[model samples]
Target: MLIFTSVTWLDLCLASAAVYLVKQLSGKKNPAPYPPGPPGWPLVGNIADIPHNKAWLTLAKWGKKYGDILHVKVPGRHIIVLNSVKAAMELLDKKSSIYSDRPVFAMGGELVGWKDGLAFLSYGDRFRYYRKNIHRVIGSRTAVNVYEPSEEIEVRRFLKRVFAQPEQLDAHIRHTAGAIILRISYGYEVKDNNDPFVDLVGRAMHQFSQANDPSAFMVNIMPWLANVPEWFPGAGFKSLAREWRQTLKETVDAPYKFAKDQIGAGIAPMSYISNLLKGRTLSAEEDHMVKWSALSLYAGGADTTVSTIYSIFLAMTLYPDVQKKAQAEIDAVVGTDRLPSFADRDSLPYIEALVKESLRWNVVAPTGIVHCVSEDDIYDGYYIPKGSMIMPNIWSMLNDPQTYANPSQFNPERFLDNDGRGPEREPRTISFGFGRRICPGMSTHRSIHLADASIWISAVMSLAVFDISKIVENGVEQTPEVDFSSGLVRRTLSHPEPFKCSIKPRSAKAIELIQQDVNY
Candidate 1:
């Protein structure tokens, strides 16, 4: 032992350096060229190039320079942004077997345990099981149609909440969304004030956004830091991750327990979980999938309709003429005697187009779900390496000037005024997002089929009753800017930065209808 080490410290350092160099050199030898992007620095590799907030805008601008497929490298990861629908569809949709896997986020996915949810599940049997469980419940248009009556009833409650507290429009929207998802996912109805389930979802979603923020945790930036033990110096993130993980687990478990209790008493309503658990003895695997599959509906898809519902109010407030047009269409088709239901959905073309516009205006999951490639391949002559994160920039694709006329304008007519060109591209194919909820990661689309009925009903009923006008303060009309979260930090959903609009009933009849008690 004493005769052992001939190597000095410098020699050991040099040996490690040589090994790193060899690996780097081998990795650099790509089979084909990488898609064009702003040149990254030698060591940092585009660390300064990407914006933390509103990164999609910067990526879209890069698309103009780099073509549809743009590549950017960070310290230890390669990222590819699919800026066109064709490219996204070709890679993430068509060749999905390789492109559908997920890259685990250090904070949300792994440490906080969101990886157990469908949104972050890797492309494998668990992922398929989660998808299978969800599909049987709300996969198709017809399947989602089963929820139509509940949708109408809850939107009607939303109307009552809005009519009662117009100033708290955002809260009411979140409340209604939570109410609907709870009833559908578990058969448990939410309490109007301080509902524990609703609060749990809100906390979980807030943590989800916090996890997306690079500043919230250093581990998000230097993922290797995740390996540091809890007792290590300045490893406070471990404690925080543990706290957040408990919240996520409660979010998954608490509601699930409620659903099971209801089933045991034989008083459970037909719901995603109830249907899965009723009169059947599920294996341990089936039981695990059922709980998370229910969460996929709650913590995942809960905000799906919340974001689009805001689109309706914002659209109406900014463009009163468009609101008037939509109201007139609803009035003409459904009349004012009663609230509009899904039965009237087919007859109200303008209201239907309004749903499309709302989705298009503020992309629900703007940056899109990030997909991981399992193997190396060349796409359109560019080398797409394995483990590259493929983010379909839904914002870029939806807002492309060529695909959308007046891309910035909030006009529902874009879908209607296609000049016989088949009503433009359907926003649903893109708007529901190419993958699952919270922070975007590789997964299947939560899909427009779930949000469609809610958005349309909310829009139709809101317009039919309430006139959403610009808020007036001190006798001066104030226009709410089209903004979400002040662009100060990163965000997962495009929730509007707090804004005010004057929401008032259109008539005495409207007031009466809004005040009317909604039946289950």
Candidate 2:
């Protein structure tokens, strides 16, 4: 179908201009070399070379041929792919002062108005303020520990949900994460089912992923396309962006109003926003900071944890031996009488390693949030121009054979120092991010680590009670494929596509434990 039949003329003109522009840029003289990458087209640069799915694989393949850092140009954009943790850390980390800024995303940031959120906020006063707000709440292990009770309570509820309907494992995880984040972020408790706020988050986040996908919308690569009026021929993306922008607005506004309203009634539970709002009068700017920062907590923790935790179940289903080993450790250390808790975290080394393995294995946010350089500098004899987009190829870093032996295998023991060989490098160091822009996100140090305790609690509690195995149809066991998909950031921790598994209580005792009262 020629969906853009009326706008083919417009697209052709844009392509011609793009071709001439790239030709001009490539014809320039450079003081030093750019990192080697696949040769792009004569006209459109590397636009055709970019894949719409599993992009990390293509980038990693380029690394094998072009070295760790590969530069590619597409239309008006210049991209540098860092396929090794060393290269990422050297540039994105050691050179943090000039590397922490975020790209101005055309579709998500400009069109849908998500740039105000911490994830896409530029490096400036508001970025620092947002980070300060986030860190004050969950900056440290001690601060995050404050939410342990809430996390354990939600994971227990998750166990009950999975027990009741294993087929809806995906929905159960999403609800549980939303419940935990909303409670902490707004002090608002979500209903057991069909919670409006959770539903809103689900819808809003889906739009978020679709909006940021460069390949999904032409406006992302060509920002001017966003200027096309809704009534213009083949302007469907513009229409979609408008609708998505409203959803993003509600995602930002609705929860914020709820938290403020609850505070007004003098019946607000303590939460991230309430902690900031309880007795303080704020300037409109401060209020904006608190509101969006609170949503940042919701946006970051809620979605990604779903992906990380879901992968744990998928890991258990496909690798029964690893699951049994970890479960045995749980039984040995925590016992069957009660589910595991944060207090037992240090005592269960295997479970801890299992959590680390899961983080590495799943590779959430595989290609991390793009980092925009603030100035130009030379590194390793390469001319890294200012405004060149840097993508930390996190998927390659975690799975690099040089970093981990048999990187493709799901073995928790790789994280355990055994037989005189030290354990492989911890995945968290690479997974969360690199340098000033690294996800310690709200503050300088935490990034995805905000959810570390949450992931552990969920994993420990679920493992303590559930036995996950391959589902059998017609008496034949079906193995769940280990597939993790990525879009832009919000889709960072999405569900495994076509996930299938059977989750059940290990025994009547396990059932009783999952059935415990889940009030904190």
Every candidate's CA RMSD: 5.7, 2.5
Q: Clashing pairs in model 2?
A: 131-442, 439-447, 440-445, 440-446, 440-447, 441-447
The Cα local distance difference test for each model comes to: 0.79, 0.82
TM-score of each: 0.92, 0.94
TM-score, model 1 to reference: 0.92
The Cα error of candidate 1 at residue 114, in Å, is 1.1
Residues 292-391 of candidate 2 have per-residue lDDT tens digits of 8888788887778888888888889989999899889999998899888889988999988998998899888888888989998788999988899999
**Model 2, which residues run further than 4 Å from truth?**
1-5, 9-28, 441-448, 487-495
Rate residue 497 of model 1 by lDDT: 67
Count of steric clashes across candidates, in order: 0, 6
Candidate 1 C-alpha lDDT tens digits along 1-520: 0001232335433544565577787856778999999998665568678876678888999999989999998655789999999998888767877888888878878899888877778888887777776776777666778888888889999999998889899889888888887888898888889999998888887777677564456566557768988877657777888999999899999999999999999899878898789889999988988898788767666776777788678878899999899989988988889988888877988888888888888887777668889999889999999999898898988898888888888988888856676676887787655533322211234343666666778788889999999988999999889875422114455666677889999999999989898787
